[model samples]
Target: MDSRLDDARGAGRRRIPVALDGLEQWLRIPSISGDPAHRGDVARAAEWIAARLAKTTGAVRIVRSAHNPVVLARVSATRPAVARLLVYGHLDVKPPGPGWTSKPFEPVRRGGLLIARGASDDKGQFMAHVAAVEAWASIGGPPLDVSFVVDGAEEIGSPGLKAVLDRHRGLLGADAATVLISDTKMAGPGRPTLTVSQRGMLGVKVVVSTGREGVHAGRYGGAVIDPTQVLAAAILRAARVVRRLTGAGRPPGPTDADVRNGAAGRAVHRDRLAERSTTCGALTVTSFESGSTAGAIPTTAKATLDVRIPPQLNVADAYRAIAAALRGNDHPRVDLQLNCMASASGVLLRQPPTVRQNVDRACRLAFGRPAASISSGGSIPAVDLLFRIFGRPPILLGFGPPDDGAHGPDERIHLGDWANCVETSICLMGFLSGSVTAASTQHPDSSFSDTLFPHGSRGTAALL
Candidate 1:
């Protein structure tokens, strides 16, 4: 073990509370990217983090994008380094819907968990890494050359991440970076997990509208058309398509014990992922709005659906299929429209055994156990883009507890798990420093991803 590792770990442990404080402060911003009303709040959150990071990082630049600004920073190596690394995470959060015991923006500590909208999802998880970085800074600097990109529009599908990457192409070259992401969830509470695969997603908004304004329900009960009823029919049609699309995907998943410790739900059958068959659509109706008056029929009713896309299925093909189903049997009185909110290809990350070994060693040291690589159902739209850019899939670390209620009410993070996460990240930095060789510990047949991802590591991009 390198002396620096112990020194860095000690430094990190001593400042663990600072990390918690950071999470608390940032959670108050209400940086909901999905809601246009919170646009400025999102940007404010980015600036707040960037300013704090500037103290230890070099050239913390805020790059403007079509949607939200990106915060970029570099941390120079204090000594000789073996790898050039990039960290990615998001700062934006999903809208805080109903059902909260406390205020969403106000951070509340309940028992061992920290309650806030982005707590377990990314904010709490990524702050661990931020704390680790600050620790290294306290002891001079990190052993590996590192840079981070904090995305401000990830919740809304990172509409401008590609352009931001393209603009900073040389700084974040595909040949240079090994990515790391902390936006995923643990297999279960207190179980350290590494996500090796992610599903693709296509989000569409369904709107049923009448040309005229709302009318009295009694007057239009039989004469006029109700968009709400039409919207319901459309949703019903979508549900049927989902049933047929996923009919061939009832295959059982692997049992948990070895590789899938505490993993929930059956896994997606490869056949389903490869062909048009889908394991599940996750056709979540995120938002629904219609009439407000009790006695009136609204002019329009709209709702959004988030459908999962198999890695094998292209976004356009899935889009066309769903669009056709929604319009195949149109309602004459009401017009329907589709707003494509998100579209991204899913990718199966094949990280080298060496990379897994490095992270596993850290997990064991920090969490009392090694990690298992699992496929995740949730979609992080930027993962595929980063894979293409880096030529290798980044190592996705899950620090949040399972059932953290992300994107829903009462979102929270376990403080104990959070401490472990900070320690694990600190250990990873030490391992990646090229000072500690895990050659003996690496599993046999370990090889780099036919090509390691060329994209940058997931930074506060997932947290911000």
Candidate 2:
């Protein structure tokens, strides 16, 4: 084992309690961004993070927006040649759903796990970055310049974050080829993973209406054109078209090769792909409403659908297809209205030798195991926006374990994984700083040959 790794392991053991204490305190604030009532709590959480970052030997500022404030801090190096690393994380959490063993606002420790609303989704995972920075600052800071951007409205699709980045682009400039984000999780405990790509997402709510008023089913059953029935037929047609477009029920497309290659890289752990695809079904049909009474015909019907597209797919094209499908239906009485459309562009991680070597070496030094690159099915819109604004590929790495139950009740972070994350963060910083160097000398822009998968290879059909 390397001396630095030994030091990091020792430091991580000593700092676990401190990190846990901080996580508990941070999780206690109900910074739910979607709820208007929790605005004060959101600001309070931002203030707490800003104060914490200010304690370091650097320039820290609280950048506020109309929605929530972002904590931006910087530690400069003696020379510009040294790489400048950007670290980002979120402070706000989702609303706590029912079924928690304890109160969502109160962090509880039981069976070596910390349970709270934001304990795992982001608050715990991102705090590991804070803990890592704190550890470095405690030992006189890093050799390279480092910047931290902590946001508070990530749970709400980061509405104001792009504007914030655009406004402060000059202050956040960087020459580094990569950025680090700890907002995602590993496949599982002891299986260190790096997320290389994330599928794009588009959410839309469609409401169909026909008649002006609801009528008794007995009198209107045969006479009136029921909007609910018409809407259901339209939805069915849209579903079949989407299935055909995705090549779900037919032979795989050429893109299947890429999917399989991505899956192979991600399948280092058992059930990893299965876990990633678990959201495919649950991502759609968030809510629905139809009949007002059991025996009455509904005048209006509404349903919200969340569509997740792979990195290789086009989002705008998918929306157009959906709109055409809804409009082409021969329901004279039915009208389709699109409520909201949130689309995220996809990004692929740069597979530079330096990046792969650094991530692999760092994971080995920290956990005595090699790390694997994986594609995440869920979407992180910030990843696309940040990369576009800064022109740097953001590396998604974290210490979260599977079944952490983010956005669900009883959200928790594994204590052992938390300690491992601390060690990993320290080792990654040291590795990137050249405490350890790679054997290969490849340019950061070098592109590797993409391997395609058999399952995702078939081309999608024209749904429109």
Candidate 3:
């Protein structure tokens, strides 16, 4: 172990309390971006972040989009020779669902866990970076220039963040290395992780309408076409199209090798060959409406589909396939309307040697174990967007533990893990400072193979 790493870890342990305290305060605000009622609380959270950043050696600015405000802070290096690093995370959290043992907005500490909305999803992870910056400043500043871009609309798909990035391109510019995001999970409890890729997302509300007016089943049994039947046929066709698009009945993507070998595979029983090739779609019909009453043969029908596509798949092609499937049906009165369409963008992080080395070293030094490199199935538009705008591969090294229930009921952060994450953040800053220099001077294309687990592991941890 390096002496500098040892000293950094020691410093991190001493600053755990500071990180936890900040997390507690941050979780108290219900910065739920989806709900308009929480707009004030969201603004307050941004202000709180701005104030905290102001206390450090940086120029903090509160830039507002059409919706929420983005807190941008810069910690300039003492000497201009140092490189610039951009650190971004979301300040907003998903809306709290029901069935909470404690209040969602009011954080509660029970045993060694801090339970609250946004505790692990983002607020806690984001705060870790803030605490790291503060710690570095206290120790006479970091070796490189650091900038923070904390947004409030991340939970809502970063609707207004692209404009924000475009507007502040100059202020947010850097030496074109890698941006760091602490908004994902570590591979396992003790295993640190660096997320290298994320799957794209396409959400479409497929509405199938058949009739214009509600009529009694007895009166319109043969006369009117049932919208429900038409909708069901359309849904089935859509499912078939999705199955074809995902290459179902075949081996999973290359990334699924680890998942297939892990506990996930054991539970599902890999020996069951039929299930091995099955590619289950996460298509969810969130809402359905047809007919006015239970018994009456109603007039209209509608259903929404939420589709998750892999990085290898194209969202537009998938959409066209689904549309073509629906077109095959000859229901004269039925119509399909696409409510929303979002294309996903992804970047491969395997080629960047510096990013991988820094992430692996930082996580191992901080947690006393090897860190895993994994790809996320969920989408983070900001990651891809940042890569496009800055031409830097973003590394996601988060501290959130498994089953933190982010975006769900009783979302919480393990107190101990939260503290460890703060340490990890500090270690990452030092590691990245070194990595940037090494990467800048070394080969542009270098790939490292990751072997955290054997291939074919199908478990929640592996899949997620």
Candidate 4:
């Protein structure tokens, strides 16, 4: 074992509490991007992370975007860098939904888990990498010069990411040899799973209007049509439209056993798990407004519909189908308005063997086993753009448990798992930088032939 790597691991273990403290402080900020009411909170959260990164890198800056600020940070290796790496993660999180055992923003610890809105989904996952990098710096820094681009609007499709990247190409590290994204989850506690694909997304806003304003329930209840009923009908129609198109037969998606090797919560899904992976267009009305005053018939009901598109279907095609389905013959009883909020295509990552082998090696060093690869059902809208900009597929590695309850109440991350992730992250820098030997890339007991010919002369992980 390399002495420097060993020292870094020691340093990381000692500072586990420090990492938790940082994550806890950041999690307290409710950076919900979807709602206009919390805009100031979102900005505060961005600055909080910026300050933390700045302390280590001394090169942190927050770039203003149309919707939110993007925090960028960079640091060089102690020795000559073997590679330039860009890390992508979001600081923003979804609006805290219902069913909280405690306050959504306030982080709490129970045994080994940290409970908070962004704990499992992204903040904890990404912050693990930051903690790893800082620990490595305490020893002798990573073998790779590192750059971080933590965005603040990932919860809302990252609508302005391309623009931000376009405007600040070199400042954001255009020459990155590879990209790292930690916005995914492990198959299970000890399973270091790599996510290789992401579903696309189509955001639609639906509005149903029956009158100008709310009227007395006694006066209008009998004669007028309720917008809430029409709104519910529209939502149902949109969901059916997606199922009809994406579910022509069985939807193609990860099955129950395939999700982190069945470590996920059991469900009796209507479609097969793999059938649902890419084909189960999970249409949801994320937010809705039916009435303001009690006992009064509201004139309008609005909803924000989020349709997840499987990698196989075009987002545009799905959007059009949903729009047509909700139009519903345009009768005089109700006025329906549909707004296209955002749309993005799904991406399938093509992993070069070197990337896979090195990542496997990194995981094995920290977890006592090789890494597993899986396809995630979730969507990260800027993945395709980030891949295009970086000229390579981003490695989607994360440490959150499969059932962390993200985007809902009681979202949490296990500390034991997170520490393993930090150690793996430190090891990944040395292995991925090509500073670690080629033979180490193979499983310890594997024969030479198996390492070279694992896939028959592809020479994917061969030393240069």
lDDT of 4 by residue, 31-60 (tens): 988899998988998999899888777878
Highest lDDT against the true fold, candidate: 4
How high is each candidate's TM-score? 0.82, 0.83, 0.83, 0.83
| Winner by TM-score between candidate 3 and candidate 1 | 3
Please report how far candidate 2 places residue 103 from its true position, in Å: 1.4
Query: Against the true structure, candidate 3 has what lDDT?
Result: 0.66
- Stretches of model 1 off by over 4 angstroms after superposition: 1-3, 172-174, 213-226, 246-278, 291-299, 330-334, 437-464
The sequence of per-residue lDDT tens digits that candidate 1 reaches over residues 1-464 is 34676667668778877778888999999898878898899889999889888889756888876688888877777866668778888899988889788899999876656789999778888788889889988988888877788899888889989888888865543356788889987876667788766667888899888867778889778778888888887877776665444323332222334223222244644343422322355466878999987898788898989788655456677678788878764556668988887888876677787888888888877766798656666788888988888888888888876667788778877776777788788779878765754323332131111112122222221222
**What would the per-residue lDDT of candidate 2 be over residues 1-464, giving only the tens digit for each residue?**
11343444355556667877888898999999889999999999988887777787458777887878887778654344366678888999999988777899999766556778888789898888778767766655654577888888887677788787767655665545357888776765555677777667777788888868788889879888777677677677666555544312211111334334444244433432333342222235778888877888888988878767656557678677766776676756567788555777656666578877787876765566667666666778889887876676787885665556688767777665576677677667767665434342221121110111112111111100
Q: List per-prediction Cα lDDT, in the order shown.
A: 0.74, 0.68, 0.66, 0.76
Residues 1-464, model 3: lDDT tens digits: 12243344455556666667777887888898879998999999999888888988557888987888998888865445245678989999887878677899998766456778988788888888888777767756765678889988887678878888777766765646458888876665545567656665666766666656677888768778887778778888877766554422333222344445433235543453322222333355667777668667766677767665555566677777777776666866567666664555544555377666666665554455656766565677788888787776777776776556677767766665565566666667776666322222121121010111113222123312
RMSD to truth, every model: 8.1, 9.8, 7.2, 8.2
